[model samples]
Target: MTDPDRERPAEADDEQPVDAEAFYEALDARGRPVVTAAEVAAALDRPAGVVDDALSGLESDGDVGRLDVRAAKTAWYAPGRADADERITVFEKRRDVIVDQPAQYTRALLTQFAHLENTNREGGYVYTVREEDVWNAPYATFPELVSTVRSALGGRYEAIEEWIEGQWERAHKFRLATHEDGYVVLEAKSADLLGNVAEPRLDDGVLRARMGDETAWVAEDRTAELKRTLYEAGYPVQDDRELETGDDLPFDLDLDLRPYQADWIARFADSGSGVLVGPPGSGKTVAALGVMADVEGETLVLVPSRELAGQWHEEILERTTLSPEQVGEYHGGAKEIRPVTIATYRIAGMDRHRSLFDSRKWGLIVFDEVHHIPSPVHRRSASLQTKHRLGLTATPVRETEDQEEIYTLVGPPIGTDWEALFEAGYVAEPEVEIRCLPWASPAHREEYAASDGHGRRQAAATNPAKIREISAILHENRGSKAIVFVEYIDQGDAIAEALSVPFISGETPHARRSRLFDRFRRGAVDTIVVSRVGDEGIDLPDAEVAIAASGLGGSRRQGAQRAGRTMRPVGKARMYVLATRGTEEEDFARNRTKHLAARGVRVRETEPVAVVDPEDASATPDGGGVGFEAER
Candidate 1:
């Protein structure tokens, strides 16, 4: 069949302009290609001048392009010629593609695909790698392949055979060199696959496809066609277009989730068990609660701090299907306890009566910030044995080695990075602007440089000038409702006093801290400075900003929690790290980020604080930890 003409004339048997359908019909009437205005007018029973005007309109709308124009003659049409296949488009035109898909077997597929690509280059066929193709596998594991194909290929398993046949006929003969249970190894010649008779040649690390055994290269426009063909054939997964918005949320919370949040939840719920790792405030609590709504029986949620336990209680009551009767809290100052409980990791980790050693049955146990599970006591308690487990944390484990151990104990990583959620508007996009306080300032930098080890971090963090700078920033953004994070109670007290904001430290009374968080969430107060106790699973949905004035230690869990405080997706949020120019405070801040590489958290220079409109009362865009640290 010849290509369908895709053009419309200015006028076709009408006093008014022809509609889009009529224009398409006119093109269909012209079997070969677009005709001259005179020819179109004759065919449409209209005057040549009217046809010319209509073609001009079509050209303006990108429906057609004019090839030539003259006084009494004119020709215009769509730019590209029709190919045999209309369902072809480009993939990852000019971007680098990472091989991360089907999360279950990403590494397995990467290994196989890379090996095949390297070994299969001997034949005449050429291979054109699209950015998105970086994530495909041989689909050797038929069952898993069937599931992925059904979801990705519009539930059309029948098309798989046809696509394979077409690819085989078009390309050099291909074979799965190694086909096993869940893995398949493939090798194919590019010439055979692409249906090009050109001999493939490598020039400067790029493989070029020749046309008709000639030296001429295929036009760049043809790349998309080739890519779309392979894409429909199920060679790879598409880039995530929807945000992780927690779409499969079991029970609808009175909240609107961003796309990334939905996606994250879906991935986890589908996987049944794994880690949901991202920077803090990425809505780990909300995500955990969402999962609890779907799971059968009671869920026990373990947090790291009392502040977090209380925060979880409030959020559970506010956002989950669980009733106060069903949900329980096992913490100090708790009046009632129920089946679906929220308990502190420290308390749960403690060997109160060595009861943890006994096998206790639970429908589901959620470890909020499960990275803390690696602690000797927590690990021992957690090792008490439970099959169904969910590790919810902004950062999971500290580094690769820890991740390996965590994987053996917990499960593989399930959720995508925080940036995925951030860019999709699931979480706010942070606007980062660096204000490099002068390192030459002798008062702070000099003292910090002279101190040794931990003292240096303390010196840098407590420097009068640096403190004043943070205090000023806090004062300026005071209306946005912020949290000042400090490493020690003394620092929290000092910073709180300096900024004149209410303080909650480890020593803060349970009832008082609960009241303080309540006041912060209600907008009755603006800022609350706290020690590390506030870093873990606490829910401060109203707080959109966090200031890390100190606590720049290498505790990946702490770093993740501090950043997470501002990532809650409650509205928009921003996290500010106040470092003393060039001090251990900065170095410690760097150490705090070591755990995020695997989880894909990119820690960089501080992002700009967003202006909070009192009328809106939403959090500002909290710059997610992605990309890399900026040079400050």
Candidate 2:
């Protein structure tokens, strides 16, 4: 039976989880060329013995070439491997694929069919393709998926491809479509499968009644749970329920979308849902607003913080024809729900606030920083039941469970090429470096050694030596706008005091914080020391240099956000990640920034010899150590 969804539509990349060629291409995506049976098993979510049998069959069929393990991992990893050589490594067993020196178009292609684990600085990347990735593949039909895989890999894996086919088939077994009677009904291909799979998995009250042998009435406000339950049960319910565009809030997009952004809007126009994952400065917010205008219904924009909410307020007012009265802020300071409301995730998820948002028939619900959607508290907002839901984020990095929940809650990951954006001069490529600073004193080293767990992390993160390094960077890049990031308020205060800059944190008065931020934006202030309050979604576009004096417990998202601060269109930007030398900080520094290193920024390491004395830190020669060039 040909399903309507499986039919080829004009949209090529629709974020469904199945594409024919993904399984075989997973084996070929970059890393070490020779994959063991265990790796294949992990990638396919099958057993090692089963993978070995499959590989053995492939070997017999002369479809797969086996190389000796003695070939050396580096030998298999061709430096800057291009499209023709296809320098991609697949550990199907681990369900991970690393693209080495990926072609610009390849990364864009991979996101359509795989979940990005991390990107490399050397134009390489790591991806994890699984049942969800294949099931949410952008293509409409199994044959189209196969065609994409063959086109991507220039070959195929019949065995794992079979696994992909089954998963894709599983995703289409059921759907929640609107009946002509204006009620949602769960329709399945077969009554037996629906009774056996759907009836058993859904909650007691969810399936209100049976309409026919293969369709059932879906309880009101139970659609989200029903879809989630069925999805976990290995059957992704296609939501074809009719969606209202809500009360018309007339507005026109004042900004022109890049080609990719336009394509994103087009694909989303068809499905009415998706997450726009673009790098910072790649204009995800712009694309999201574009979608808002396209939807043309009353919209609800949920942001991670009030700062972002306010930013969205300004952006909406500035970029669209929407009047200030048409838009309102709903967060800690405000609770006015207007035709187009922007609220914080914290408030939007609250019981009292839920009604104000849910009561409105929103034409669209845009989840900004969509990465926050998977959290326990934030996930509640996902139940708002907007037909056209859109999400926006620079870093979509999260736990597998959280990532999957985000995909399920909001929509599948949709992004443009980070490298392509950099290449096109749309976003500046940052010069990133991990600077290993010496301890301010032997006492600091002793304290770090004596501390344990979080204490140890804090000690290293707040090492006084980072101040000297930051000073040196500032001195060299004097007059350039800079922002120093710290993990603790105390450290932020100290850095701000030494630098003679304002320290903005959660405790900062809203008016004062706004004043400081405004001055910095206008170049009235050259720098500011801010805590986690400045870690995300702040519009500091003129920031030329960013220094991370402390790590956020080594979170890759935080690292990327810090580096992303200096990334803008048509400028040279630089980022410095400071870690105390001869400590665990070295490892933490590397671990956090590796995500940015590969995607578009090539990270260099520098270990300085000089140490700064805390008592006379300012007297230190040129801020503690002769600067070394990018490490070999």
Candidate 3:
């Protein structure tokens, strides 16, 4: 509100006091205190430039603050107050917390039992406590969690605190432990619940014998099913087994961990298990090595594919003092059971391979891409009884909405705020733009409308016009390391053919895949087109750009994983998601980008840059119009 003619803030400026009160009110009415500056400007019915000036004044006066605004056009802002004011603002009805001007320690304390939603530019953070957060809170006793909640809130929130206590107690009702005779045992905190809730809920095949009213002998083979069933029944089984600490294999990490990595290791050590939910390039692999060093015992690392297994094997050798003889790879190609072994989930879950892994008293078991822990084959790997368990993932999201199973099977989510990591220069936050394209031509639109179900979906996903847009993007970002992701191999092949790049798919032989990926990493090729295999298996940290030409069936985790491919320690990274306008791809694109948007990533819908019709004989396409250009 300061006059442009004034050298400084004007006197009698009480009226020009940034009008922060109105902005806050507008933001509150929008049901989220955090918003882009553009959003608040629209809500206030004021000129965006005027709103920007007022908000900037408010920020100067410490009344308003920005969240971690990224390189894109998105500028996040929220209300702030004096440091002496209550840092934690609880919304009882919504069960969310808005912490203003919170210190690093306060944020760390809150993460023990609250899910950090977003971080404000004022160094404040937003967090929400869910049932899973309470259940997985790294506390041996309820009092510890309560103390943390109260300390972070700066006082008791009676209604929410009581609700949290109830959730914590529910998690304690059932526990899975090792019986003295070397079998898995299920115990209930009370007799009635065991007899009434657990016993009847589990079949005879699951519970072999009733040791007592509150205890039962569980079939080792059915342990995974038992844990999953009780969890679905609202009584999650706690794994408190006296499992093996494996043979001693001591080593030290050659890498110095970042502060956040150290904090993660500290928390994981206290719990003896946890999932490291960090963005890609946040040193999760190195942190895992630190964990292995802390455990000082043989470890088993489970990955979804052989590429990741090999990556893990190489990382373990390079980061730790472990030698090649000390480490081994167990998969279809090779089967070795050394002290430190990396195995695919399928190999680890097999009956024969399961025995081999079971026989080794692994002090630690790390599940890379732990999001896969909930699948049928991967869930079998969760049955292992070990002293320490760790899961790692950039996106702990699943379309099935069963991501909580990952927490139950492995451990709680332990992560630094992604925004914090970005701010600290540990990981670069990628700019994401959703490019919606029109149909390739009248013929293409007609074919899409004429078809049904899968045919229609295929038409939208493989729109020929998208290839033109991709060409324009690559042309603009030339000399950048890029990966074009596709869901279908046929589409990938076509794009590869058009782009003159190698296409890597599941059908690509291991040696060929390895050679292409190596070439990409070595900068021999600036770009490559890949299929779904690149979603999780590809770990190229130097990728500067990711163009999701065709996303899979609207998987939120897949979208996040693709964006994570470019999260690096330096330089700007960008993600372009292409979808056919006026088709199911619109909804699919939204669903795909939802996770990254929720995590404070800037996800904007833009019209693709001018795409020409290949069938046209002229310079422009038929019925040509200027294309939508994403904000640079």
Best by lDDT: 3
Candidate 1 residue-wise lDDT at 354: 34
Question: What would the C-alpha RMSD of candidate 2 be, to one decimal place?
Answer: 13.0
Q: TM-score per candidate, in order? A: 0.54, 0.78, 0.77
- The whole-model lDDT of each prediction reads 0.50, 0.74, 0.78
Model 3 residue 280 lDDT?
89
lDDT of 2 by residue, 589-611 (tens): 77788667545466778654334
Steric overlap count per candidate:
44, 31, 3
Best-to-worst order by lDDT is: 3, 2, 1
Better of 1 and 3 by lDDT: 3
* Model 1 C-alpha lDDT versus the unseen true structure: 0.50
Error of 2 at 295 (Å): 1.5
Q: For residues 1-632, what per-residue lDDT tens digits would candidate 3 score against the true structure?
A: 86664765443333343376787676665554345566666676655677777877877887776543111223444544223433568996677989765543355456667776654334455678888778766566787678667656656889988899899889889888898888889898889998889878887789888898789888877776787788888887777766668679888888888887888898888877889987888989889999999889888898888888888888887887888999999999999999988899998899987888888878999999999988887888887867899999988878888898998778777776565666556788898888887776666778899999999898888887877788878877888899999988888988898789999999999999999999999999989999889988667879989999886575888999899999997588899989888898877776677566545565666667766443544423222332425423
lDDT of 1 by residue, 558-615 (tens): 7656666666556656666666565556555555544332232333564333221212
lDDT at position 531, candidate 2: 86
Q: How close is candidate 3 to the true structure, as a TM-score?
A: 0.77
Please, what's the RMSD in Å of model 1? Answer: 19.1
